[model samples]
Target: AIAEAIFRHLAPRATPLAGRHALVTAGPTHEPIDPVRYLANRSSGRQGYEIAGALAALGARVTLVSGPVDLPAPPGVALRRVETASQMLAACRDALPADIAVCAAAVADWRVAQEATRKIKKAQGAPPPVLALVPNPDILAELSTPGPDRPALVVGFAAETDSVAQHAAAKRARKGCDWIVANDVRPETGIMGGMENEVILITADGAEQWPRMDKRAVATHLAGRIAAFFTAQRSIA
Candidate 1:
């Protein structure tokens, strides 16, 4: 680590992401069902946090809009903590116009239409109360929309239990994002909430399968690709 730091200090030009702004979303959004209850997922925020750190290492100014997670903020990155999916979307919007945006948060799709003010007491011979649900804002699609506010590159994540690549491809087209990183999160795979991951990166060209590795390694690889993308764009211009 000491040697790497000395090398970085000696060669400042190695930071390819200098002057770039990156916006990343992490963890699981908690949509309220009531004062003490909420809808959420199993995301631990490790992958997203690692990605933020990797980008920051490459010298990008990163803003991580995260949901409920116990992890500390990555060094050299600005952290924005939020709970509900609506708040996550608002935070992402506020952090634009970024050069790159990675939508890695596992936001809840539905939220209780109306949260109960107080907990109901259990009673015998009574039917259970039915809770109405409403769809949350589609953050990936919104950020991918073609506009001045849209980032140069938008990446979304798809966690699927089956047919991961196929679903992710469809999602990329539907969401209008530049890239989609798809992974199998079936309990058997142990990728979700686990230390490692194997992913399929879908882009305009095609899907590329990445070997199983630690989440931090995956983050470093993705950050390198992002830097290469900007470099290619600059060369073309």
Candidate 2:
């Protein structure tokens, strides 16, 4: 089934994404405190990678700005590996003017103020070491805000453990993005770093709920919907 799906996706199609450049960000950014330790999320980059693959299959010039992930790079896509949120933003800036920009990366909200040159060890009579943290740049917010080189469509991911749809809808408005894909990451569900997820698609117009499906299926459906949206826009124009 996997092989057949790959072949079908790679087959040529007349989708609107074809021939247009699409930029996708995936995985969890690691914020280093010491050489051997870092703060990161549970995102495994599965969904982001699948989205890139789906877009590529539709013939889009796909550029994936990925964070640290164990998964292999997607076939037939330009891969830019980044470890920090700042680096990811730089890559996105360089890949601008794309038709679509998907911010799928679970970025670290905060980072250590100063990275330790040497790993701190336990002292004979001391307490645990203290670490100062500062907020990381909001990469999605920066991209979605009106800019000279902003993409036509900006999509963000909101991983919410509670009030999933409401949080995602608010994020869409707060981040100034065209759409937000909201996922529930509660303990029992295990959506984060998991194979399957139930998602709510939130846009300015309204919200749509989709049944739980594998990450690959979600990506395929999103790609097709994007194509249809562009088609409608063209017709209206």
TM-score of each: 0.95, 0.92
Global lDDT of each model? 0.94, 0.88
Q: What does the lDDT read for residue 213 in candidate 2?
A: 98
Q: Model 1 TM-score? A: 0.95
User: What is the C-alpha lDDT profile of model 2 across 1-237, one tens digit per residue?
Assistant: 487457656764554576689999999999998888998877899999999999887768899999999888788789999999889889998998788899999999899999898987879889888889999999999889897778778999999889988899889989899999999998789877689978999988889999999999999999888777777887899
The regions of model 2 sitting more than 4 angstroms off are 1-13
Model 1 regions more than 4 Å off? 1-9
How many clashes (backbone atoms < 3 Å, residues ≥3 apart in a chain or on different chains) does model 1 have? 0
Model 1 lDDT per residue over 97-146, tens place: 99999999998988988877886666898998787899999999999999
Error of 2 at 182 (Å): 0.2
